[model samples]
Target: MKLISGGRRVAGNDESTTPRTTGTKEGTPSFALPRGVTLLFAIAGGTAVANVYFAQPLLVTLGRDFAISPATLGAVVTLTQLGYGLGLFFIVPLGDLVDRRRLIVMQLLLLAAALTVVGTATIAALLLAGMAAVGLLAVVTQTLVAFAASLAPPAQRGRVVGLVTSGVVTGILLARTVSGLLADLAGWRSVYLTSVALTCALALALHHVLPPRDTAAPSMNYGQLLRSTLTLFAQERLLRLRALLALLIFAAFSTLWSCVALPLSAPPLSLSHTAIGAFGLVGAAGALAATAAGRLNDRGLSQRTTGIGLALLVASWLPLTFARQSLWALAVGVIVLDLAVQAVHVTNQSLIYTLRPDAGSRLIGGYMVFYSLGSALGAIASTALYAVAGWGAVCALGAAISCLALLLWAGTRRRTPASAAAD
Candidate 1:
C-alpha cells in the first residue's frame, strides 16, 4: 500500500509512516483509527491542556494565601508560559522520534506528580517551580494533537484536528470556571489537588486505550531533532506565516483573559471569583467556531477565515473596552474573542498539518513556540498595562495586536497566489 503526504507518495500500509522514508517495505501493517479513539484523543488533549490554565483563576486566592502582591503573582503565569514555550521547542519534538503513546503516558504521570507538588506546596518558590513543571509537561496536549493528525486520513484530517483542537480550547476556557468553583468551595490548593486526581485518571485511561503505533521511529538524535525544528521554520513559508499570525492573535487573547479578573473583582461589578469564573462558560460559546473553521479549511478557505477572524478579533476589543462598567459588554467580547482566536487557530493547524504529514509533531511544536511566546507576552503585558493605564490600555493593546495580525495576513495574501485566491 501507499499514501500521499506533503505532495509525495510514500509506501506505507497506512497513514503512520516514518518521516524519513517515502515508502515502506512490503507487508508493513497499519490500521484505521475508530471515531471512538478520536474522541478519546480530544478528551485527552483537553484534559492535558487544561493543566496549563488551572492556575489562572486561582491567582488571587493564591496571592492572598502566600502574601504575594498581585504584580508579583503575575510572574507565576509568565513563568509557566515560559516553561511551556521551552517545552514546545525542546520536548515536543520527541513525539516524532519516540513511541508517542509511551511518551504521552510518561508526561501525564509527571504532570500528576507536579500537580501533587503544587497542591501541597508551602513555599512560594516551591509552588512556582511546580507550576513551571506543570506547564512543561502540558506539551502532552500538542503531542496528542500530532498523534490525531497522524492517525486521521488526509481528507478528514482537518475535521479531526479541529475537533481535537476544540477540546483544547474548551479545556482552557473551562479550567478557569472549574478552578474558581473548586477554590470557592475549598481553598486554592484544592484546585491543584483536583487536577492531580484528574491527571492521574486520564493518564491511566490513555495507557489502556491509546492505539499502538507500529511505525519506525525517526533516526535523529535529540539535539538533531531540536535543530530540525528551526530548520523547518526556515524551510516552510506557510509555517512561518501561520506561526506569526498565531503569535499576534494569541497575544491579543492573553491580553484580555490575563487581566479580566482584575476589573471584575474591583469597582461596581465586584463579582466574586465564582462569578468571574462563570465568564469562561460564556467564552466557551466561541469555541464552537473551531468546527466551522475546520470545515472551511477543508474547503480551502483558510486564508479567508484568517482575515475574518482577525477582523473579529479587533472588533472584540471594542466591547471589552466597556468591560469595567458593563458585564454584558465583557461577555459579548469574550464570546467574539474566543471565537475569533479558535477559528484562526484551527485554520492555522489545518494548513500546517497539510504541509508535512510525516513530521506533524515537529511542525506543530515549532508553530506552537510562537503561541507560547505570544501568551507569555500577553500575560506580562496585560498585568503591567492594567496597572499603569487600566483596562482601556489593555483593550488598546489587544486591538493593536489584532490589527497587526490582520496586516500580516493582508501582506501574505499579496505575495502568495493561494492566499490571494482565498481573498
Candidate 2:
C-alpha cells in the first residue's frame, strides 16, 4: 500500500522519511538512533505508561483512606482510562502534524505536573480530577512509540517495537509491585510523588537525546485530522479487526487485575498490599513473550500468534477462578494471562504499522482507543461484579470476553488475505 503523509504519497513503505537535519551544516554529523537510544525510548515509554496503573494494587487502601466503598473506588481507574481513551482520539493524532520531539517533551512535563496533583490531592474529587489529567497526558507513551517506529528501518521495525513494548509491559507489571511497596512504607501519596520526580528526570534526558528531523507539516486542520482517523478506520479492515481483538483481550486482562486486589485483601487470603503487589512479578514473565511475539510477526506468523493468544486468554480464567483456594493458581493464571495479552498486543501493532507506516501515531492512537475503552469497561465492571457476585462473576465475565475474541478471530481469519494475515 502507498503510504500517505501530509496528504502526499511517499515512494516507499518505510516510515523513517522525516528529513534529517543533522548533516545539513558543516562539521555536523548524521547519526541513526543507536540501540542505546532506542532502549532509552523504551524506558521512557514504560515510565510514562506506568502512571496509569500504580493505583491498582492500592485500591483497598485508597478506599479506606478516602472513606469510599470498593465499588466507588473503581471510578479512580475507570476515569483515568476513560481520559486516556479520549486523549488517544483527540491528542495523539497531533504527532503527525508537528515536531514529535517537542510534542513528547511537552506532554511529559504536563504529566509530571499531573502526577504532582495526584500526589498532593487531599479530597476524593481532587484525586479523581488529577487522575484524569494524568491519564490524558500519559499518551506520551504512544508518542514515544511512534518516534521509535519512525527511527527504525523496516526490517528491524518489529524488533524495535517488541523491545519498546517489553518496556511498556515491564512498567505495567512493576508499577503494581513498586506502588504497593512504596505505599506500604510511606503511604499511597508517596507513590505519585516518586513518579513525579522520575517523570521529570526522564523528560529532561529525552529532550537532549532525541535527534533532530524535519517533515512537511500537515496541511489539514485539527478537525480534519481527527475526521481522517475515522476515514482510515473505515478504509482498513485489518485495523478494525485488530482493534476489536485489542478491545476484547484487554477487557479480559483488565477484569482480572482490577478485582484481584479485593479478593487478596479479604477473607482466607488476607494478603497485604505489598503481598498483593508481588503477584505482579509473576505477570512479568509475560514480558519475555513480547520479544518472541515480535520475532514471530517478523516471520509472518501474526494470525497464528493471535489464535494461540486468544486460546491462552480463555484458559487463564480457569486457574484464576481458584484464587481464594490457592495463591499458586492465581499466580499461574496471571503469568499466562499477561503472556497472552502481550502476544496479541505485539502482533496487532506489527500488523497495523505495516498498513500505514507514515501515520504511525494516528494508527497506534486509534487502535489504543479500543484498548482504553476495554480497560475502562473492565475496571468499572470488575469491581462492581466482585462486590455483587464475587470472584466467580469476574472470572465468568473474563472468560466470556475471551470467547468473544476467539470467535471474532475465527470468523475473520478466513477472509483476511494471506499477505495481510502475515501467516
Candidate 3:
C-alpha cells in the first residue's frame, strides 16, 4: 500500500460521511427523502438495472439484425458491461461530492436517450455506441444504493441494501423475460421503448417521493475522493476480501447466464426464446429469498448468513451441469444460483456500507468496479469457452470459480478491530 497524507492511509469512512452541496444547505437533510424512501430506492435501483440488462435477451436478435458474428456479437454485452464498470469507478464518486438525486435523474435522462438511440440505430456501430451510453448511465443503481445506506439508521442498513439488491436481481432476471417476450411479439425496438417509459416514471417518482437533503456538507477535494477510493482497497482487509468473493461468485453467475443460451436454445433442448426467458423467474425467486435473508445480518448473523449463502451459490451450479436433459433441473439451478448471488451481494453491501457511511457513493462505486469487471470476464469467458469446447467446459469453469470463492471465504480466519469498536 502506497502512503498518502495520512501516513499509512486515509480511512474510506471519511468519504462516506462527507456531504455534497448544491442539493441542499447543511443541517437540511439533502436526501431527507420522503417516508416512502424505501420504495423509492427500490424503484430507482430496479429501473437503472433494467437499462444495464436490456441487451441480454436481445443479443440473438441483434446479431441476426446486424449480421454480426458470435464473437463480435458478444462485444455488445462486453462493451456495455465495461461501460458500467467505468461508470462505477468514475461517475460514482460524484455522488459523494455532488447531489445524488440530481445525478440520478440526469443519468436516467441520458439513459433514456441512449435507449431511444439504440432502438432507432440502423448501423452496428451506432447501436454499440447507444449500448455503451446506456451502460454508463446504468450506474445510477450504485447511487441509489448509497442513498439507501445513507438514509437508514446504521442498524437497518443491511435490510435496506437487501431490499434494493433484490430489485437489482429482479431486473436482471426480468429483463431477459420481458425482452424475450416483447422482442418476439413487437420487435427488439419495443424493449428499449419500454425502458424509456420506466425511466420517465422513475424520474418522476424520485422527484416527488424522495426525502429532503440529509447528506453531510461536502469538503473533500477530487484528489481526496480518488485517493479515498484507492485507500479503501489498500487499508481495508474485509472490503478487499468481500469484494474478491463478489468477483468470483458473480463470475460464475455471469458465466452461467451468458452461456445458458447456447444449450437451452440450441442442441438437445431447442427451447423457445420465451421458454428460455421464463427460466429467469426461478432465479428471481432465489433473489427474493436472499433479500429476506438480509434482515438477519444485523442480528449477529452476517457471517453465518454469508456462509450459508455462498454454500447455496456453490450448490446452485450443480444441477446446471447436467440440466440440459430436464428443464426442471435448469430451473432449480437458476434458483440456486440467484439465491447464492443475492445472498452474497446483499451481505457484501451491508458490510461495505458500514465501512464508509459518508462516501456511500464512492464506496459503492469502488465495490462495483470489481463487480462489473468480474461480470465482463465471465461473459467473455463463457462465450469464448463455448466456442472452443462446449457448455461442459463453461460449467466446469464456472464451478471451479465458485469453489475457489468458497475456499477464499472459508479459509480466511482474521478479523479487524473495528467490529469491536463502539457500535
Best by lDDT: 2
Work out candidate 1's RMSD over C-alphas. Answer: 5.4
Error of 1 at 2 (Å): 24
lDDT tens per residue, model 2, 64-180:
887878777789899999989988999898998888878888999999999999999888889999999999999899888877777666666678888889999988898899999
Output the better candidate (2/3) by TM-score: 2
Give me the runs in candidate 3 sitting further than 4 Å from their true place: 1-35, 416-423
Candidate 3 similarity to native, TM-score: 0.89
Residue-level lDDT of model 1, residues 1-423, one tens digit each, is 222233222343333433222231233322244565667778888888877887777777778877878776677888888889988888888988988888999999998999898899998899999989988999999999998777666657678888888889888899889878888899788888888888889888787766556678888898999888899988988899889999999999988887888888877877777888899999987668988888888787887888899999989999999998788999999999999999999999888877777788999999999999999999989988887788899999999999999999888776753632453
Q: Candidate 1, TM-score vs. the true structure? A: 0.92
Q: Give the clash total for candidate 2.
A: 0
Considering only N, C-alpha and C atoms within 3 Å, which residue pairs clash in candidate 1? Answer: 11-23, 11-24
TM-score of 2: 0.92
Give the clashing residue pairs of candidate 2, or none: none
User: lDDT of each prediction vs. the true structure?
Assistant: 0.83, 0.85, 0.76
Whichever of 1 and 3 has more lDDT, that candidate is: 1
User: Model 2 residue 123 lDDT?
Assistant: 88
